[model samples]
Target chain A: MIWNEEYETMPRADLRALQLERLQETVERVYARVPYYRQKMEEAGVTPADIKGLDDLRRLPFTTKEDLRQNYPFGLFTVPLDRVVRVHASSGTTGKPTVVGYTKRDIRTWAELMSRTLAAAGVRRGDVVQNAYGYGLFTGGLGAHYGAENLGATVVPISGGQTKRQIQIMRDFGSTVLLSTPSYALNIADVMADLGVDPQKDLKLRVGVFGAEPWSENMREEIERRLGIKAIDIYGLSEVIGPGVAAECLEAQNGLHIFEDHFIPEIVDPTTLEPVADGEAGELVFTTITKEAFPVIRYRTKDICRLITEPCVCGRSFVRMPKITGRTDDMLIIRGVNVFPSQVEHVLMGIKGVEPHYQIVVDRQGTMDTMEVQVEVSEAVFSDEIKHLERLAQQIQRDIKDLLGVSCTVRLVEPKSIQRSEGKAKRVIDKRQL
Target chain B: MQLEQIAIFLENKAGRLAEITQILAEHGINIRAMSLADTADFGILRLIVNDTDRACQVLRDAGFTVGRTEVVVVAVPDRPGGLASVLNTLTEAELNVEYMYAFSQKSGDTGLLIFRIEDLDRARSVLQAAGHRLLSGEEVSAL
Candidate 1:
């Protein structure tokens, strides 16, 4: 069922050679086209010519999210605007979004990679894919959409949201493959249970491809048991060209196979920025070699995971990254949306009468992640009328949702209730075990 | 006349009401008439205490979100129709009542009903003109 059998089942030596070649080409492309990369490489005292072997990727400077933000919209893009067939933007640490562009060939490569990802997840040509990932500026929906389309499957393009309709369509459309974040999949399953629609009897879904957020093995088991489908974890960030970067094969389902032909994966110590040994957990890094429009060289992804170089039963020569354990930073992914405590602070600081002190409590209710923002009720904000307090809560909730695009419950607590740390203020208290 | 009511914000958890009661008890502040307005996440405990300033000060010092509300206390009959008659007077006068709570005197025949009227002065005058007795802050606190 491997869509790209030649690349997927290539020998280890051949895969390494291919990765080295792509890496060399990608380094040269960025150095020549992007000034940001050129200046960074010059500062690091390394040129494209220095990337002789794949091991020499460490010689080049690591491109961070800060670099992307510095470049803004199109500064890091290798290809011209006309050459780019598509653009996808994700929420940045600040208010701005990190934008990624894809050339026509880049789009084709993405489709191939995604088709390979779907094929690994057990999706065939005739399989009906109900893509529940959000479409728009966010990469999940359209990324899964084109991939499923390229795989010759009947893509429902039913982007995220609408729970009841998703269940109805799952039954009506005879969809065989479901693509969404793991939490959304669980939410759908819960809705199905409420509607009395048993997935085993009613739906024809055989496989699910979930990504965009970190999920646990227990969560995978829960989804599998409830939905009656093999839940496969797909790993990708918008920076590494969205969801097709890596995915778990149906045979192994142990770890996600990094498509090394297009992108070279690296594990590095977050603090020292030194490369970690294989199978040792560290921050996951990627170098988009085949990406013509947005070729990133040694991009530091804050996601923490280990790389398993052992050959999987799936027969893919590429290394598999085990499920992401934690993050290197304080960034949080609530229901697939990337939210930072600073962003919440940014929203809170703008509003009058609210103190800067706030705590974010992330809890998983059933399969859904519920974020409750507890802000201390200062003397200025505290009102005698319950309606005014309710209105204040609603205002905070609305503003946070408007900024982060994630709905959360805003709870106004008493002043000095949010615990203060000894040295630094601990803003986020994530109650979810995963 | 308007009576100053202490409104304290409390998280909806077990022993939260008890904690507030303990705080009032420690301060020797007698709660005259209190009503708890609650939602799923939080609750607002509105209390007419013997010492308004002391109750608010202690609650604030204890890290509780406390506020002062001006509520009108009206003396009504202890019968069932007592509430309806006072409400009807407000309805006839077109005065809006945000919220209302009651406390009956054990010895006296009249019951004191606390009303969070939109226009406190106007509602007090309307109630007084309707042959209703209004309790002063001192009189309400004494109960």
Candidate 2:
């Protein structure tokens, strides 16, 4: 099931040599074509000639989201506007969207990578793919659409929303593969239950390629159990050629294999901006070597994860990265203690009767920080006697403290009280002024 | 005999109780006896209704968390110490009543008490042995 076995199963030594050559060409091309990159390279006292091999990637200046925003639309493109065939942007809530452009060849590369991603997740030619990612501006929708088509699979361009219709289409169309955010996949499963449609018996969804947001393993179990599909994690960003950067192969669910032949990934200590040893958790950085229209030299993804060069059982020689545990931006400093919303989610998922719907509210109380986790309980647990309910709340508090090492108040709300999201579930609400 | 009581979970907010009762009224289901236990955040509305299955269905369809529990309904005299006498007998039999509520017939000199005990069958036999009359679902609905 290794898609494009020529590249996916390339020997490690050969892949490294290919990565080095691409990295050198990308650094030289960006330095010569884009003044912004030239300025950054000069400021770092590093020239294109300095990038001799793949290990020299650390010598290149890191490009961040802020850098992309500063450049805005088309400023970072190596090719002219006429050559850029497609434009997609990430929705930034407060400012202009992080824009990305793809040349005709770049688009083809993206489609090929997505095809590889889908095949890795067990998607085959002629299988029906129901793409539920949001289209327009966001890369997830169209990115997955073209990839499904490129993979020779039937594409149902059913973008996100219309939850009821989404379910109906899945049944009537006999979709075997689903493409969407992990949270939305769970939402679809919930809607299926509401419609009395048995996912296992009534639907044809055998595998799901879910990404665009960080999710825990517990969520994977929940989605798989509810939707009766094998949930596979696919990782990418609009900044780095959209949803086909890396994907978890069906044979080894341990980590996602980065498509190393196209995008070279590195782990770095966020604070020091230095590369971390392989297998150590750190911030993830991607260098799009083959991108032409908009080539990022060394883009800081801000996602925290570890890179695993360990050979996968799936026969693909590509390096694998574990699921993102958290983002540097999502880290909260409460009373000098660092906490991530994913940590709290991990704790809540272990406790019974507590639905995955939860919100972490952090506020300041006279120089001291207070954290409160508001979670929803199932109907059966919510209807229990008062003392039992109180005990459940206390147990959650104890578990969070024991697991996360942070003391937080636990509030058990009634079912459906918490607002559910169609995309990324908002898990944190920090009211601290700082 | 065992009687079925419907329990609905209601958030402790204004008009919640009215909402449930309105749904029941629209369904033509009459509430025979009821008791509400509440905390600061929520409440459980337990009721002895004329139609258990229909009431539960309508309320659940309206998005309410509703469940049913079995209880023993006894006919106690309206005179003083009547409920106390029944409680004393149950105490002698070591049967614990989890919860209880009462209602009276307009013309009768007797009050009906709905008792949710640990064991419905054991409570019925113990109460009947002490000359207490237990009301069945049919008898309670007719009243």
Candidate 3:
């Protein structure tokens, strides 16, 4: 399908009109059933009559993850559990798992969204889509699973974490599309080479949609080069109904088209939780309309990104958001100063002779919080002795402190000493127990 | 001769030892002997407390991992070479002492040596037959 015919390429007027209709109905349904939403709307001084269209969404109160947890399992459901056919839950680090329910219609809507996301990434009919996302609880697997099936492709529901098996399926299945996190994809490439198979030549993969983790663009290019596939970033949350919420089209440009028909998007201040104007960086908020089991209104996503008002080179006419830079919760606060590991990664990428494997250690020494980072030395920059290695560490420390405005001690470790993750790498080790 | 030890697993951090001790102290648990084994990310702290079961329960309820094991506690003369005598006996027994700690009675009558041994029952019987006094749990705690 061409760009114009895709749902992402809908005209601006039609997109807005479609969003308003969905928003009006979603608001009316929530106000009638969900008690927590009714309380929030009453506190925000909004009623079903107030939200006539998308423009009036601002008057309605925004729902939050805490609301879902407080109403854990099925409190937020507009329809009973009998009507709901499926359930998805968060990792529940904050508290009880924030569960989301979906009706058969809701599942269809989700499948259709994933199909749109895949088509945007150029996964056409007759292609083999290898989905390596984790199957249960996480939306990455099943979301891609349905989308590939709808695209008329042979589906490989290869759930994540078996290094050897992943490579085996990619080669044996003749898979044309590989779906996994960027790190796992790179690890798979490394394993393929170790297994004496050429990643660029042996595998038939032409496209990749990687998500469920944060990675830099440098990492993306690295994966693309090793695998020789156009790796596109897929964005989604279980609250908004999984992957295919938004995707990067063929333009390979600065944004992803937000599927605005079933769900409305808003950019808001990370701290105050208020809306910001277009072309500004802020936390993403989503309001799920046309949902039957669990419809959330204005749930804050906590991701830091910017949405572009201009159309893409592919002419999708949809507002494409920039790749997420970082999460507010992941930022480290040391001795009354704020810092992010990604900021350190940005500086390290700019400098030569430094690798990606690093760990932050925070400890209390003599009435002060001392911060230290252990950076792993790759084959490219291996050095001998504490004297020479300490000098290299000092240079890294100076550069990171200059960029991040926080002083830290840097120690160099031998290659592969720092732990690597199959999914999300553990980045921080806080020795100071709070 | 037997030494009572309490082992508690703690996630590596600054105030963990303090937290474990404070929890014991709150419940009137006194530490008779203690040692620590550490790794990069975590540490196992061992203690011989007045009441082993109660102390472990208190720490467990407080979210600290506590465990129990038998340690060799032997009595030697309070004079010089008191520890040396026990060492020579263990050497003859072919027991390689991994780690150890020392404490004394309140009257300064005898010296108590705690040894981590590979064979607890055999070492205890050998030391006892050699006429060494094995202090009971109460004797260690009361001292």
Candidate 4:
């Protein structure tokens, strides 16, 4: 399965024309099939005819994750229930799950796109790929599994847990490609040594496709060292058809390609629904052009990225997006300064004698916002005297202030004191009441 | 002479000691001798390991927070008051002992005690001047 050759390497003139072609049909489909979309367009006093091309995307109302939840379940799905072939739901941290639906055709599109996504990472037929993402309600596992199978590659559906067993299979089964979160990949790398296995030598893993959580370039390098494999990034959400939205190629250059023929991409200011200049950072928006059951229009992804127009080293003409810096809505405004969890992670990884398991606490005291970062001391380090612990806390505080330009109180907690999650780790606890 | 000690800070919970030790086992690292001091909610894990660096890294990557230090490494009298004999001089020198513990029963004829003093150089001098032998990092690691 190859990318639509015309779309993959299309000239700017033709690409824009193709986009306009799909944009027109998508508008009428949403306005006709989905009642919520029809109501949203009506409330905004806009009609299908108002969206003439990419320029008129602004006229259409933006859909957010909250909008998906407000509609809930099948509310946002355009196709009839009988026609839908699959459903994937996000475990919302706040309230009801944000569910996405897909028809048989939509499912096929997802698998084919995911196959292309993995092939770009060099995962092909006969290669044994380990699928470490959790199965069931979460899309990470099954989404990756089908893609590997779609390419005729042997997939090890080794869902999360039983760490010792996972390592055993990676060895006994000769799994050549690893797929999972970046953190878990590192965790496995650290464990391989303990089981009398060398991550760089003993494992047959030639490539690792890591996603479902954000990671830094420093982390990617660290993984490459520990696993002796080319680590690539795959980007997608369940709403936009799971793990095959876009992927990094073998070159590991710039950003991921849009796979735009299937999923139309846009960068918009989340507040005003206006597109930003091409190179500037803004929220990512998508409209499913070829999807059947759930065709979202101008769906605000809330992920921050910049669309690059320059040619990629991989020779694909698809629009590439910079790695997501952080989520727009996830940004916490502390005393009018923007703070991202990833920014804190970068600083923490750079510091010596510091661990990544940290909690950002936001609280209000006397109308002023005070941020406290609780960095858990490694059990070995935590065994030191009280004076050393206090001094280490001071050093971390200084580093945080230096990096973030905000004075945050740093506290040292004992190991195993903080909780760990199975999904995306919740690093921040905000109590600003805003 | 500063003693080399393995310090492990553990949460107030059951099986934490076992967890750290399990990680050590995975790395082919061994704990020659170890000790623990606890408060109401947390415990301090101090141990003598064959490979401190590898042991420290393995525990850290597993999300177990830890660090290391150089204090007094010494071979004292096997009998009681042997420790008091050495500590008495520091006591007279106005140095406060923050915390102190022994290595293990395997360290026969050479029981070790790690100490924190007001000054490292001064503490080394006072102990040396009192005829107390301060062991080197190599000697402590050998134990």
Which candidate comes out best when scored by DockQ? 1
- What is the clash count for each candidate, in the order shown? 0, 0, 0, 19
Residue-wise C-alpha lDDT for candidate 4, range A286-318, written one tens digit per residue: 987788888888888889898987888777778
TM-score of chain A of 3: 0.76
Query: Which has the better DockQ: candidate 1, or candidate 3?
Result: 1
Those runs of model 4 whose alpha carbons end farther than 4 Å from true positions after fitting are A1-6, A331-434, B1-143
Question: How many pairs in model 4 have backbone atoms within 3 A of each other, for residues 3 or more apart or on separate chains, i.e. clashes?
Answer: 19
The lDDT values for all models are 0.89, 0.84, 0.75, 0.77
Rank candidates, lDDT, best first: 1, 2, 4, 3
**Interface RMSD values for all candidates:** 1.2, 2.4, 14.1, 3.3
lDDT (C-alpha) at residue A260 in model 4:
77
The window of 10 residues in a row where model 1 chain A has the poorest summed lDDT is A377-386
Clashing pairs in 3: none
Query: What local lDDT score does residue B67 receive in model 4, on the 0 to 100 scale?
Result: 67
Kindly report the fnat of each predicted structure, to 2 decimals. 0.61, 0.07, 0.00, 0.63
- TM-score against truth, every candidate: 0.89, 0.60, 0.66, 0.60
Lowest-lDDT window of 10 residues in candidate 3 chain A?
A: A379-388
DockQ of each: 0.53, 0.13, 0.03, 0.28
TM-score, model 2 to reference: 0.60
User: Which one wins on lDDT?
Assistant: 1
